[model samples]
Target: MVQEKQSDRQQRLDNFLQAVEAAQKVQDDIMKYGLEAAHLYCDDIDGDWLETWEEDEDGQQSFVELVTNFLQSDDLVAVKVRKQLKDKSLQEIAVNLEKCLSLSEEDDRIFAVKKVLLRGVAVAESNRGTSSDEIDEIELLDLAEELLDKLAEFLVSINR
Candidate 1:
C-alpha cells in the first residue's frame, strides 16, 4: 500500500511541499521561539528526503529528487545569503549551509543546525574582533533554525 501510494505524482508533490514547509517551521521554531520550541517543531517534519532518492539503485525521480533538482537550478540560497549576511565570510558562509529535511532521519537536522550555528558564531566573532565564551544555547539553536528555514524555502521555490 505504501509503495502504491508513493507512485502517485500528485501525492508525491504534495508530500514534497509539506515536507518543505514543515522543515521550514522547525527552523523557525528553533530560531524564533527558542531551542525548546524545537521539541514542538520536530514532530511536524513528515515527508520524503533528498538523499534517499539519490541512493536508490533505480535512480527514479522521487518527489524529493525532483524538488532538490529544481532547488539547485534556481539557486535560491545564494540570493538569500547575500541578502541576509553583511559579514565578510559570505563565501565561507555558503559552505556552512546545510539541507533541512531528511525523512529518514529527523534528528540529523539538529546536528546540521549546530554546524551552521558554530560557523555563524565564528564569523561573527571574527567580524567583531572579539572572542568570548558567551554562547547561549537558545540563540545558537535559533540561528540554526533560521538557516534551515531559509534553505527549505530555497528548496520549495523550485516548484515556483
Candidate 2:
C-alpha cells in the first residue's frame, strides 16, 4: 500500500513538472516574439494567407506528399515569426490586463477584457485606416500607453 501511494505521488509530481516545462517554453516563445502576438489574436484575418489551393483531379498525391510539397513551397520561417509575435503580444496584454484589474491569470474575464481593449485601439486608430500592426514602434508605444490609461479610468468609474 505504501508503494502504491508513493507511485501515485511520483506520477503527480511528474505531471506538475511537465506542466511547468511546457509553460516555460511558451513564455520563451512569447519573449522572443513580442506584443505583436496579442494584436494578431484579435485580428480577424486567417493565417492561411500563405496557403495555396489547387484542385487535384485524380488526387494521386498522398497526404504526406501534399504536406511535403506545401512545406517546400511555404516560407515557414516568416510564418513562424509572425505567429510567435501574435502569441507574445497576447501574453503581454493578458499580463497587463490582469494587473489592471487585479485579477488572477486564470480568470476568464481577462480574455473578454483584452478583446475590448483591442477594439478600443481599433476605434481610436480607425481615422487613419491603419491597423495596429502597421503602426511604427513609437506610435505603438504611445497608443498602448494611452489605451491602458483610458482603460484604467473606465475601470475606476465603474466601481463608483
Per-residue lDDT tens digits for candidate 1, residues 1-160, read 8777777877889999999998998888788878678557456445454455454455454344443343344455434334334352543444444343543464577566566546656777787886747767665566556556665665565434
Q: Model 1 — which ten-residue stretch has the worst lDDT?
A: 77-86
RMSD of each predicted structure: 21.2, 20.8
Q: Over the stretch 33-52, how does candidate 2's per-residue lDDT look in tens digits?
A: 77665553447345453333
The residue ranges of model 1 lying beyond 4 angstroms of the native Cα positions read 1-88, 98-104, 123-132
Query: How far does residue 51 in candidate 1 sit from its true spot (Å)?
Result: 29
Overall local distance difference test of candidate 2: 0.48
All candidates: TM-score: 0.35, 0.25
- Candidate 2 ranges beyond 4 A from true positions: 35-160
